[model samples]
Target: MAVVSVQQVSKIYGHRLSLVNALNNISFEIKSGEFVGIMGPSGAGKTTLLNMIATIDQPTHGRVLIKNQVVSRMREARLANFRRHELGFIFQDFNLLDSLTVRENILLPLALDKFSVAMIEQRLAQVSRVLGIGNLLARYPDEISIGQRQRVACGRAMITKPTLLLADEPTGSLDSKSATELLQYLTVINRQEKATILLVTHDAFTASYCRRILFIRDGQLFSEIIRNGNRQQFFNQIIDMQATIGGGGRYNAITPGH
Candidate 1:
């Protein structure tokens, strides 16, 4: 079954004066255990679309459904609770708390939900070992390298065993080598945990890691390409599509007012 469904969604800022359509008549579905990429040029509403799916923003019209539940119309308090338990987020900046130890950071979600100490410990053990951050659990965020920090962030997101994982420029802050490594780790998580993922990135190389991609332009889905055989070839195809769509250079992260 589809884990996420967006149907004829649109986002409008103002009624008439100074109006902005962040997304227009957008529709798509992501199946369970699928790794999908949303790619677009700057100002193409990739993040806005991601925000809708993440339950961080409600669309002006239409619906967003996760596991058959309507997310856009959910009350704020319930939505907040649902997001904490069901949806996991990985951001470009890692978003780890500076004051907390790595172990604390990874367990923040469970702690917020008041999971038992024993349960939290079990979750941390499972996720940390899978993400390869178990060794750095006692250290503070500042004490770790960028790659390790990103892995910690990934562990934090996955510790709750969320149904769907949302990554917004997850590899943006890392070097090329680190980015590749992190992407490989994400693939492992997707396969082993059977987690559905929606990745928002502007880099063709980043999107290549996904099983399929949705291309957006001017707030609408322009195209979609499924990976056929080799990932290296698919990466080149993504680049070619990006170039054709006027995305010249690599856009590692979204810049406001692009």
Candidate 2:
């Protein structure tokens, strides 16, 4: 099933002189339970596309559908509900509240919906266990390592049981080991939980973790590669493709490499 559909999407800014086409005639379909990555250079509209899918931004001349529902046309209030119920997000900055403990941070989603204390506890235990943050529940964000904080962010995003997970540079702030571990966790989550994932990343290594990838350039869809055979080979292909796109590693700077 197609969990997300973007058809001829375009986003324009300014009048004409200083106008910017953030995204231009972009189209794609993301199927359920698939791990997909969006890659591109600095001005390639990766974050723009992710924001459109997250319902935080709307396109100028196209429609974005989530589960066959037109999200862009939904009212703001309804969109908020849709976001709360259908989408999960992990940002580069972690976005966890400094004042809240890891457990409390993970419980924010359910609490917003008025979930009972018992239910919240059950969810906290389940999600933390899945993300391997079960023992850090009592610690505040300042008390844990960057990796642990990112995992807590993951737990918070997943605690809501969202149908689709949208991750933006999730491993950008971690060490190489932490980044690899977090990527592995994401792969496991996708496979074990059957969660559809749309990740915006520029790192070939990170994209290798995805089952498929969509490359963008100059505000348009450029190419795609599927990882049906070997993951290591796929990683190499991504690197070569980025080089082919003619940027001195600037492509990596636009997404995960940040």
Best by lDDT: 1
> After superposing candidate 2, which stretches have Cα over 4 Å from the reference?
247-258
Q: What is the lDDT of candidate 1?
A: 0.89
lDDT of 1 by residue, 55-164 (tens): 98899999999999999999999998999889999989998999999988988888767677788888888887778888898999999999889999999899889989
lDDT of 2: 0.88
Instruction: Give the per-residue lDDT of model 2 (tens digit) for 1-258.
Output: 899999999999789789899999999999999999999887789999998999999999999999999998999999999999899999899999999998889888887687777888887877877789988999999999999999999998898889899999888898888998899899989988898999998777788899998998999999998987777777767877788774335344333333
Clashing pairs in 2: none
The runs of at least 3 residues in candidate 1 whose Cα sits more than 4 Å from the true structure, single-residue gaps closed, are: 249-258
Clashes of 2: 0
